[model samples]
Target: MQQLRISIPKPCTQNWADLSPAEKGRYCSSCQKEVIDFRGWTADELQDWFANSNGRVCGRLSQKQLDYFKPKEVRHEGWSFSAKVLLASSLALLTSSKVYSNTFAKSDSAIHQNTNEKGSKIKEEAKPSDSLIIIKGIITAKEDKLPLPDVSIFLKNSSVSGSTGDNGRFTLQVKATPGQKLLLEFKCLGYATKELEITPESVAQELELEMAFSDEGLTMGAVVVSYRRYPLHKRIWNFIKSPFVKHR
Candidate 1:
């Protein structure tokens, strides 16, 4: 039972009613992000949402929801929404790279590790002891372990973004400096949106984006309709008279 308290200190200035409908919630053109509607979500679902999204999350919750889910601050040190990868050997290149993540800029600034002709790793020239880090990973369905193709991944509040290929492999190149936090957002239809937070001291390591299916996307249980059982004679009589019976 993970209870979370949500407070929107800086509420969005955009009109909520004017926003267009989106898959998870509404799409706000101003922010270029989907505004999640948590009003209908259960407490469990809300807890899971906050748990997965390390630290900050932007969503709408009612006053009643606020009161019910009160004051339990969830904080995770080091890596937030971190993933483990099967290919541990490939992550060696990043081990040497001192990755300091604030926020990264658009695609132009997106940088990755350089490689030689024989696939050997090469270091990119840095500006006065700056570290250029390359983050790569594969996205897969957590349930079936199947590759999820075309899943969109991007750094929050930036135009820099990429998608998983047919093999579910994705590589993002970004230049980050020390002393700030960089938040990465992964989104796909039918699955819950996942966010990963990177810090200044944290090493650029395996960024396996394994996402789980949303509660709504999961197979629902059969609807149990409770009804009074009738005797065979009464049932037959009701069936016989059903066609003749008319509402006033």
Candidate 2:
């Protein structure tokens, strides 16, 4: 029986793992014994070789070798323009979910209490006169100049309260006795709360409250709120537009 022989190409010292079992017993011509040559080059080595040769030489695998090991072309479903747009939009929405969710959570907690004071104060002497307090304000967003709806208003220790309608307007009536202090709490979904202290003088006149949102809430979406009070001229302008506003 004749012994099998294998040939080693010049300037190539690496062994290929994808060889047939019979070819594994190849001998190097430079060294006269049956030996397996193994000095496998990595992708980096190939790139370096090409770079050093100015794209002239291949380190271990030639273009022919590469072609031999090249992968077959795979058929894939083509994506339409709309599909691509939808995919990109979905990815954007997913990435922004955390931002939106955090804003919502903070807004929800904005009107909440930090600590509790369980009991109410007893009526004190030297009480001042009791007067009707009228409070009104526009609830505006902080970012995009949009209106917030369904804002709740609470007057501490009193049954007087109200809410902002769809256009972010609210009105409330409150009464105060001399030497008495009152706390007002304002709340809205996805917005920060507003708290105000009321005195007897403020009770007889109309008062405007400005609400500011938490910093985190302002980052997620369009916030279009102005501070509760507008300038005198601005109020007049708004009033002129009131007829149009009322029709809506």
Candidate 3:
């Protein structure tokens, strides 16, 4: 049903009428304004055209088929010749484009991973304040039957906080404040802070400060000192005063 006008060399017309039905289907002579009879074109028809033309079909041939049709002298117009060259060049570029795309994608992925690792290492090596501490314990009433795992453990007055780990465990670290009271606040999401007053003395040893779930949980326990006390500000001042300290 598709119709196209073909300008064949006048010398070609002598052999053109002998073209198979399929070839005739692709072209029609305008001289008599009559339809050239050729059967429906398909793979076999195309192959016959190539064979009968002594393997000289050019533009309609696929890239793989072009080697058979290479001419001793160019018969197609200059513009048509340029168009074929451009098409072949374009196909070659397209075939290799994936390699470049894949190379770029791999490079980008490596850079992203390296960046994440470098950022993580910087964060980990910076200071103890940003570090984490993992702890496991039961949140229980002195004489209660069931224990709760979802306790809200927080540093006093700060929004930075954590919840109990699975199996009633939790971990967090605040900036090392030597003299400042490090309050151990164990409050079930709906419960209250079983405030255990920690001085420098009692920080190291495993502790069990008994507290109630009710308001009556407030109680002052016996002092237990485990680690020697040194104020953080004093340490920083000493580091600054030392002649060995390098200035940036």
Candidate 4:
């Protein structure tokens, strides 16, 4: 008997859509050699296979499947790369504006506080000293104990003077140094003038004064007197004869 030899048929290269389901699962020498399948497979399966098989997948895919899995070129809205940059810049500007506004507000508050402090300091420096003593008192009639209005109250031998108010109260400011003696005089119509000595220790206290009525009235009658002198020649003859003639 002669030796027999049979040749196996090679698998046909067909698209995934043209392969029958039974043929799609069958092993092919070409696919086994290539280490990949050319049959029906989902996009997910292809992606998974590609990942696991070092970027290998089915060589043939259906047109519909390819179209479904194809990456579409997305059309961006009006916002582009430059628009994004502009938007980010705008946000940054707004944030800086808020920060600057807060800074300005704090600075303004500090400036106002400093101004007030300076004003207070200036006022303190400009304030008058306590050496200027205030003398306040009431003037009244000694006989009637009634308030005397328009009574002149003044420092003795000084031009500074104050008049009593309707309430008979008078206030006078006098510069009295430490350990200095002060003399205040009170004068009024129909009243005897009064003087009071003020010491530094007693200057702060209010004074109460009573004035007595004057005994000498203001009205006085005028007196008239006339005198006649001898002539110069008659006075000289008299003077010359009086020495020679003795009085009888």
TM-score of every candidate relative to the true structure: 0.35, 0.32, 0.28, 0.35
**Which residue runs does candidate 1 get wrong by more than 4 Å?**
1-131, 200-203, 215-248
Judging by lDDT, tell me the better candidate of 2 and 4. 4
Q: Single out the weakest 10-residue window by summed lDDT for candidate 4.
A: 1-10
For residues 173-206, could you state the per-residue lDDT of candidate 1 as single tens digits? 7667775577989987557889998864564566
Report how far residue 44 has shifted in candidate 3, in Å: 68
The list of candidate 2 runs beyond 4 A from truth reads 1-128, 203-205, 215-248
> Model 3: runs farther than 4 Å from truth?
1-137, 189-192, 209-248
Q: Assess candidate 4 and give its lDDT.
A: 0.57
Against the true structure, what is every candidate's RMSD?
25.6, 32.8, 38.0, 62.3
Candidate 4 lDDT tens digits, 1-248: 11111111232344322233333232334344221322234555644444344322233333343344443343444447557878999999999999988799789999999999999999887635437778888887665466777788889877779999878899988776677788888877546788898876796778999987553432111111122343444445566877674321
What would the per-residue lDDT of candidate 3 be over residues 78-192, giving only the tens digit for each residue? 4676678789999989978977787987889999999999999998887654323333345553533334456676767767577664455555555554455666677652234
Worst window of 10 by summed lDDT in candidate 3: 217-226
TM-score of 3: 0.28
Better of 2 and 4 by TM-score: 4
User: Which sequence of candidate numbers ranks them by TM-score, best first?
Assistant: 4, 1, 2, 3
Task: Give a tens-digit lDDT track for model 2, residues 1-248.
Answer: 11111112243443322222223233434333333211223344433433333212212222332332233343343447547868999999998997888798776665353222221222443345676657676766554345556778898877888988878788887666664677888875434677888765555554545555443211111111111333344445566877455211
Error of 4 at 66 (Å): 99
lDDT of each: 0.60, 0.49, 0.44, 0.57
TM-score of predicted structure 4: 0.35
Model 3: lDDT equals 0.44
